[model samples]
Target chain A: GAGVSQTPSNKVTEKGKYVELRCDPISGHTALYWYRQSLGQGPEFLIYFQGTGAADDSGLPNDRFFAVRPEGSVSTLKIQRTERGDSAVYLCASSSGLGRNEQFFGPGTRLTVL
Target chain B: AQTVTQSQPEMSVQEAETVTLSCTYDTSESDYYLFWYKQPPSRQMILVIRQEAYKQQNATENRFSVNFQKAAKSFSLKISDSQLGDAAMYFCAYRFNQGGKLIFGQGTELSVKP
Candidate 1:
């Protein structure tokens, strides 16, 4: 695709339900990132992947939140036993390379927990 | 840890006028990158402009320019001849050249009046 693409623009799930968000980054981009944005707040970094390995997972809020980029192209963010506080827009971005490269973002997945 | 701050929660400007959005950041790293992203109602995060901390000259992209003060650790966006389409949430972001993670500010909501 020309730009980073995220699946299921919106998702509504009950608390404690498991949810998975998918992200397809731009072709040839080696770096992918996942972020969470609450209402009236900026996006918070969740995880970063360089190729197939997670370069940084320190930003992941807790064990309930996990992300994977197995093939170095498409990434998936999984939330287990989701809580009401998990309700937010999940954004996916990709950059061509590390170090000063501008990242391209997707439209984001708005997750609403009930 | 690096932190980015956008103090103005909201700002408004008339069409064809100019608007400036302020941003400040704290980082011990000498080499880093600064960015301004626009997120409209559509929820797409768009890159407006970017500045390299090592560069002495400011960066400009069409009507969008930045007043980057490296010494003060401030990067402000100046929009010339603002348009209704420019109404969106502007985010200030920082990233270290060595580390790939991007630290974002609280964001400023921009409203362009007719």
Candidate 2:
């Protein structure tokens, strides 16, 4: 079975540029999550979608960050006016559902804002 | 606030030896899940093991086992006969029963010596 996957394994952008990172969840997965990992730190939750609706977006750092899962299988994380502080690895994960289900993660997209 | 903490920033073990990584969590909720995830340089988070808060017995998989102390709010992972492939960044995470978002710790980097 295929696991979750993220596109453009690496992205480099200018401080004022915009970038979009995509994630393809596992088949039959109902829950998708996004997390950000800064250098030398653990991953911090960003947002999660249950089906097509975002169940939570509290982890998003600010208004510049947004995400959507239109068909419930693929998700895109968008960042506006990227900053140097936005440089980090963005990881995506999916699970069967909430509760005790384990999350399967993607290989993460490293975003570097110059 | 729910938070997970991994005190060890780095751990090293010789091949065929045992190494234990410590994790502690603080949360008001009683029902939740704990997880250990591994991330190598490739930057993919892989589920190593999971333990449900409602279960009293510890969880084990192959050479990996967790000493889960509910009363102490501690979960430690012990890897027996550590191999070089086991080397990676280990993270402890907590997730409430209601949501799919995960709260992760600061991760511990483990290295294996041949």
Candidate 3:
């Protein structure tokens, strides 16, 4: 019954610092995804995991961004040398990996690189 | 390879009225999924409705429904009896049948007035 959940509802950090955003998927969900949404823009896919392994990560913009999902439930998005351009809402979603299962999203974590 | 487009940046409607938001997508794949998601100020993405490409009939959820045109690559969301609570940014998204990353459109901000 619990929807996906993300930690640190808001995070403000200085440029060049490192930051980590965490996500907890819904119970029994086997698929997880991460997305980044800039101001006035639609959310862009960053990574997807169909268990503990990432199935597709082509959407990751650059080397500065990385994500990992271990044990197939929890995921963490880590940014190194954060930039002002990285300021945006980081969203997480999960689904059952079944046919046509709708993804349930978490309240995204807004990250601001000051 | 897949892209979603939302033409309306903002729309307003009186409570109890109906409003439609238009979306179009470009994709070579025939089997895919289309969805409408709502994001409130709280930054949570919620599924509004979904339409499977193979389904000839449109998808509906209560007052929310979608007009999905496969040949034209057009998908539009129609909200009936729009409530003040429906005020939010609406996004059109697309994904392939087997779990993959989502392609989202620039959102439409909807406002409902009493």
Candidate 4:
């Protein structure tokens, strides 16, 4: 079975620019999540989607960060006016359902904002 | 708020030896999930083991096992018969049964020696 996949393994952008990262969850997975990992730090939750709607997005750092899962299988994380501080690995994961289920993660998209 | 901690920044073990990685988490919730994820150089996060807060018995998978102490809020991973392929970054994560988001700790880089 195909596992979760992310597009643009690496992206480098200038500050103030807009960026979008994509994630394709495993088939039949109803729960999707996004996280950001800075160097030397653990992954921090950014957003979570149970289906087409976001179930929880409190982890999003600021208003500039937004995510969406329209059809429930694929998701996109959008950043407005990117900042250098946004440089990090953006990880995507999916699970069969929520609550205690093991999540399968993608390789992650490394975004470097200059 | 939940916080996971991995005190050891790095650890090394000889092949065929045993090594344990420490992890401690703080959560107000009574029921939750703990996990250990391994990320090799490829940067793909792989699930190692998981423990449920209500279960008294520890979780084990092959040479990978966890010593989960609910009272102590401790979840440690022990790897026996270590192999070179085991070299990677290990992260301890926590997720509440009510929410789908995962809170991760700073990772420990494991170096398996031959």
Measured by DockQ, the strongest candidate is 2
Please state what fraction of the native interface contacts candidate 4 reproduces: 0.98
lDDT of each: 0.95, 0.95, 0.93, 0.94
- Fnat scores for every prediction: 0.89, 0.98, 0.84, 0.98
Question: What DockQ does each listed candidate score?
Answer: 0.90, 0.93, 0.79, 0.92
**Residue A70, candidate 3: C-alpha displacement in angstroms:** 2.2
For residues A1-114, what per-residue lDDT tens digits would candidate 2 score against the true structure? 478889989999999999999999999999999999999999999999999999999999999999999999999999999999999999999999999988999999999999
| Candidate 1 wrong stretches, greater than 4 Å | none
The estimated TM-scores of all candidates read: 0.98, 0.98, 0.97, 0.98
Q: Rank by DockQ, descending?
A: 2, 4, 1, 3
Clashing pairs in 4: none
Model 1 residue A93 lDDT score = 96
Per-residue CA lDDT of model 4 for A40-82, tens digit only, reads 8899999999999999999899999999998888999999999
The per-residue C-alpha lDDT of model 2 at residue B113 equals 97
lDDT minimum window of 10 residues, candidate 3 chain B: B94-103
Residue B88 of model 1: what lDDT?
99
Q: Compose the digit string of candidate 3's lDDT tens values, residues A67-104.
A: 99878889999999999999999999999884589889
What C-alpha RMSD does candidate 4 show over the true interface residues after superposing them? Answer: 0.7
Question: Model 2 over residues B1-114: C-alpha lDDT tens digits?
Answer: 999999999999999999999999999999999999999988988899999999999999999999999999999999999999999999999999997899999999999999
